[model samples]
Target: MAIHLVGLALLMGVIISIYLPMITQTAKILGSGPMANIPFFAIALVSSIVIAIASGSRTEQFQKVATLPLWLLTAGVMSAGMIIGSSFLIPRIGIGAFFVLLVSGQVLAGMVFGYFGLFGVPASALTVGKVLGALLVIAGVYLVTFK
Candidate 1:
């Protein structure tokens, strides 16, 4: 089960990375301001609505959402920030560098979050391997970032 989940996670990671260039190009076309974020979210909202309707559990999901704290609902804000920031950075840094840096930061932050169990992530003791993996990611970012 764990191996299957890990594979699924890697697959999703690849998908998200592949999406970077698309958004970057859209940023170039739309001009990386409110214009970029607006259409992006509009599409996302529509897609989400379609999925929610198709789920056949829309009422249950809405009930679940209501039970959550207000702070939790602000995840959309974080998603917006990620898209807006990525729109600006991907074109400037180039896709490879932006993705490398993003993955590096995610790994490092994940290490901290996993160790401390922040944001409800299950606690895992930091090990030498985890730190080494993060260092390798940083090194990769450096290689991808510089000429």
Candidate 2:
């Protein structure tokens, strides 16, 4: 379990390193506005299709065809909206700030959802340490962008 945790941490670190740079470049291409979402949509479309084929699944059978929840659909739509919105925002804010705000938003949302046991996550509250850590991340974002 410890090894698995370490491996996952390392993998996430690598992903962050790669993703941040890509976001910066994408922002540059899209002029730091919401238009960046076009590439996001294209990537999502290709990935979804690839994943479906690789996993031997389709939208109809993706997750219980008839019982698809509205909440999930809403979340999916919201994510797409962010992708589009980010395209426009990235150039102005820069990728570092963009990711900081984006990740912080995710962390806040995740904690809220986890606390309420929403989306199958176990109920939990944000600890003081987590709050501090988030603050530090925000501070880091400020330093990275403004300084």
Candidate 3:
């Protein structure tokens, strides 16, 4: 569990490092001008795919592990659909409202999953403090962007 957590943290750090500087450099090139920001997003997407493939290949049971998810393709498809849908919806809703709703929903779903031990996870307690912290994060997002 500790190794898995460390791997996840490292993955997140690498992705963020790639994304932040790529977007910043794109902004510099565009000079706050009229060019679209798609290139930076494209670079990030390609980099993420490459990283995923590399990491996936490194597992001891890489081939078998990759094939085991055939039964849950529906869930995977739905997740991808939601990601694409969010890209379309976020601009329409505005960032503040979108983030508030998104993060709150994630925390609610996570709490339920954790408490119930869904998806093979062990049952965990969800205290009032955890819920309050989630709400505080949502409130902070709203305060930052809801001018």
Best-fitting candidate, scored by TM-score: 1
- Which of candidates 1 and 3 reaches a greater lDDT? 1
Error of 1 at 115 (Å): 0.5
lDDT of 2 by residue, 1-147 (tens): 699999998799678657545655776776753455567668878998798779865656755745876777787677656655655566677766777777777777787897788878899877998788778877876787688
In candidate 3, the residue pairs with backbone N, CA or C atoms under 3 Å apart (3 or more residues apart, or in different chains) clash, namely none
Compare candidates 2 and 3 on lDDT and give the better one.
Answer: 2
How would you encode candidate 3's per-residue C-alpha lDDT over 105-144 as one tens digit per residue? 7677888888999988788988889879877877776676
- Please give the distance, in angstroms, between residue 140's alpha carbon in candidate 3 and its true position after superposition: 6.1
In angstroms, the error of model 2 at 39 is: 6.5
Regions more than 4 Å wrong, model 2: 1-43, 57-63
Model 2 RMSD vs true structure: 3.9
Give per-residue CA lDDT, model 1, range 1-147, as digits (tens). 699999999999898887656666787887664467777789988999899889786877877876889899789888877887888887677777887788888889999999999999999998989888888887787778885
Clashes of each: 0, 8, 0
Each model's lDDT: 0.82, 0.71, 0.62
lDDT of 1 at 3: 98
TM-score quality measure for candidate 3: 0.52
Model 2, residue 55: C-alpha shift (Å)? 2.9
